[model samples]
Target chain A: MIRIGIPRALLYYQYYPMWKTFFQELGAEVVLSSPTTQTMLSSGASRVVADTCLPVKVFCGHVLSLVKECDYIFIPAIRSVQRRVYNCAKFLGLPDMTKAVIPESPPILDIDIDVNKGKRVLYQAIYKLGRHFTWDPLKVRRASIAAWQAHLNYRELMSSHSLTPPQAIEKMLGSSEVEPKTHSSHSTSTQGTIAIIGHPYLLYDEHINHRLIHRLEQAGNKVLTPEMLTTEELESAIVKLVGRAYWTYEEEVVGAGGHYLESRIGGVIGIMAFGCGPDSLMMDVVRRQAARLNTTPFMSLTLEEHTAEAGVVTRLEAFLDMIYRRKRKQVEVCV
Target chain B: MKTYLGIDVGSVTTKFAVLDENNELVTNIYLPTQGKPIEMVQQGLKQIKQQLSNGADICGVATTGSARYLAGVIVGADLVKNEITSQAVAALQYIPQVQTVIEIGGQDSKIIIIRDGIVTDFGMNTVCAAGTGSFLDHQALRLNMNIEELSRRALDSQTPVRIAGRCTVFAESDMVHKQQMGHRTEDILYGLCQALVRNYLNNVGMGKDIQPPIVFQGGVAFNQAIVKALREELNNEIIVPPHHEVMGAIGAALLVHEEMVNSQNGSKFKGFEVSEIKYHTSSFECKACPNLCEIAQLSINGQVLAQWGGRCDLWERSQSR
Candidate 1:
């Protein structure tokens, strides 16, 4: 069987299950690059311009690590997910960038997954991807249907259990008979509710985010993320925040931010790459909305290549201190 | 005569404050950190021990600032708090009605927006040291003058020239250009101060409601020119409270005092002889994972007291076990 390599970065957290299912049904053995590390990040950073965001650098690193391990590397150019809303430019040019930078890389299986190009183009792209493994059109159609079902199941598992993508992915991919642990219900806990708004790449990449979700959970604070909300809920929140969604991924930051700010969460944190253009604009909108609301505390944490954990720790600790103290004061007033 | 000891180990300075049971500062010591946190902390402790009154007994101990963990382990602190909370706590103690706090330290600066004795919002300088005291200190060194003289000379300016304060390198070149263009030295110095103030307001104090009674503290409060620039820009009186330089230490001391009072436990202080304990510090790269975390270790007399800095708490947990 021809082994296909997948870089576990960027859209991997969002669409990995579907990609794995689609490729497996086509009879290709799917191989994944290891989780990110210091060496991976440094190697990736060397391959790209200094101004490129950290996520892109990480993606480059993942691609480099997969050089000798697979027959074909899969990289899809996802330009737009909705009718008019568009992804950042980096996503549109990822395949070309990887090919240009890594001259010794394996043959890349490239696909353009732009929804704005209409249903025919989308299906044609899927068919072309499947045709590489099998000549039967019926098999291709079956694989696509299986991929869609897997994606829906992935989304369902995340929202129902209030799990991050990695958590949900682990359960579905891990032992079949083992029951997944249910997260402590957020509704019962009134205090220490923190909403972390960021892209999945930034939120789930333990190396990039410094294990942010684990740290919060360890500290006994109930954490919330954009993935836990339904598509309709996020869409309405985005409309309420900025009239309409401009960026394809704006729902992660702006929509979730607007909804959380209105809710009675203790605080809201916006995490983003240092120079991401879309994130900068979306985060600013959230920050301003937070200021207008003035009911919940908001803080923005910018991640870069710097490995100094002291700065991030200090900020997180102080933000938590502020929340706990405020909650304590409210309790005192009630008594 | 029970007192609480608070130590703030920052990037540029190490401070020690001894506060009595009534939250009154009995003695405080401030000195340049000079990149040797352990040595500076020891020296500050020695000085504080000498200055403290004879009858004062240390009832609690706390640590704050960037190197707080190291200092906490060394001093056997009862509390370890972030500088933001410590600064706010001290500000609230100094003036209960304080709505804003602008703390400009050696390497970084932060703005805290407080309402009804709670921190509502806060922001810190990100990846830039342009609007901090160290920048002023560097300019003073370049001009062959002390930091105190820079402030005095800046106060004498009649018409200040505008220097670009967006980047420290550009700001240095801008200062040189202004000086070559026959601008008075005092005018250039004051211009640099205004530029830093503008950068602070733009970067660290962005998109927040900054209200008065605004109490400005930290090492930068010593510079009258920066204080004046802040006042001019905000069109409100910027109050620099007494003991501004030692406010972080005071806040830590105050927090520990509260903790000790509630718990009814004796202080965890290791005594003033920690200055003579011959402490040793070292670091090693952990090979447990591909992250290669550089873990820092602190020991005394060949006995490891604590280890930290790893992404995972493997070493930390092992030490505890």
Candidate 2:
């Protein structure tokens, strides 16, 4: 069977299930690099220039992680899902960038997805991969369709049950399809709440964020995340709070923040990967909204591989203390 | 009476300060950057307006930090300066006899050696987190200790555990190992502080003559453990100012004050109403060369204000009409 390597960055968090199902349906083996590490980061940093953002450096690290382990590494060039709503420019140049960083040339399968121009969708991207693997086009098409349907059904079932994408996939496929659960959530109280707002990939990846949910729970605070809310609810929250529509992913976070505010929560924690453009934009809007509402204290946590635990804890404690003091003052005024 | 304003628009935070004719800090505001520094500055200005005395003559304004260029454009600043010069100026203002300045911020860190109030040499570590405030914050979270309590706790330690502070991963793994080996929490915390201080001294503070009367400022100056560790490591007392975190803004404000006194320049500040303005950014790859530099263009009301991220000056030279 052909071995395909996936660098564990970027869309890997969103599309890993789809990729795995499609490749597996075609009788190929899928390999993913280990979670990001300092060695990997330093190596990747040296390979790229200083001007490149941290995410690009991380993407390079992920690519280097898979250099010696797999036959062909997959780096997709995604221009945009639709016109005027494009991914960062770095996503469009991943293949070339990875090649520039890697000392030895590894065979790279360049997958181009230009949905805006109506060039190809997810199925077509998989079909092209099937053709590259020397499989019959008709057989590949049928397998791709089955895999796509399975993926869609899996997502729907997961969302309906308020489960994570991986959880839903596992439930649909049973024991054989099980992947390690990287994130764990626990809530202590419905009244005292904090929202973990950020990209799904960063929030779900336990290794990258280092058990943030557990830490919050250990501190005796309840944590609410974006994945728990319905798509429409999230959208309406964003519209109501922001007074304008936003990009899809950012809308979810804005809506979550809105929900947190409306709930009269103690605080809202904005967690973002370092150098995330959309998160950067959302954080500003959220801060302004939080300030205007004055309902809850707000804090932002930016995570990179270099994130130090001491700084995060200090900020969290200070934020919690601020919230506690504000709540106490409100109580005293009421009394 | 003349009043001056200085703005420091960092990637993670934005600071603003107003100074009177005597260069005394009238008021200061520090806000999380939220990636919309221009908007934050406007919000800060509005807040400052509510506090300023009526009929106060504005002398001049200065902008600094990573977003200095953008801020300079937004506020119509009289002077634009880098963080190094701005920081040195603030240090000199507070500690005239200061020979060394160590500044640790959210995302980066810097060390400056000043000779007679002039910056003779300096080094900045922006590429990594080893010497930055965020690194210490992350470690505190892992240990489940309050960040503010970390410094005080370190001062109580009788034995300091040794942690590899070269990078986050090694530090974390080494910390776990030390904990497994049954080291006291306070000792481990103190060790981590020492490791970070050592790392800073070796890296950003490398190859510089760090002399006495050291002035420590920036966000991390609040960490007493770091101060203690530095004092113990270097065997010298470190001076942290009363307004440590807002020094960059203070320095920028002082610079504006100096400019107004010497140059007779009117303040170019855009005033408090700038919060209502809408700002947008658009990006395009320049095909002028094979470099294919992705250029980000910032605009307000359809007029281009600034452009950045280009390798050469090609996009900057283009008329945005």
Could you say which candidate leads in lDDT? 1
Off by over 4 Å in 2: A1-335, B317-321
**Cα lDDT of model 2 by residue, A78-123, tens digit:** 7665454556667788888778768574799887777666645656
Considering the two chains of model 1, state its CAPRI-style docking category: medium
Show where candidate 1 strays beyond 4 Å: A175-191, B318-321
Candidate 2 chain B: worst-modelled 10 consecutive residues by lDDT = B312-321
Per-residue C-alpha lDDT of model 1 across residues B133-245, encoded as one tens digit per residue:
88999999999999999999999999999999999899999999988999999999999999999999999998868899999999999999999999999999999999999
> Which pairs, if any, clash in model 1?
none
Error of 1 at A8 (Å): 0.9
lDDT for each residue of candidate 1 in A1-335, tens digit (9 for 90 to 100)? 99999999999988989999999999999889888888999999998977889999999999999999999999999998888998999999999999988888899998998888899999999999999999999999999999999999999999889988877888788733122333343344444889999899998787888878767776678889999988888888899989999898899999999888998988999999988999999999999898887789999899988845778888999999999999899899999
User: How many Å off is the CA of B263 in candidate 2?
Assistant: 2.7
Q: Against the hidden reference, what TM-scores do the models get?
A: 0.97, 0.50
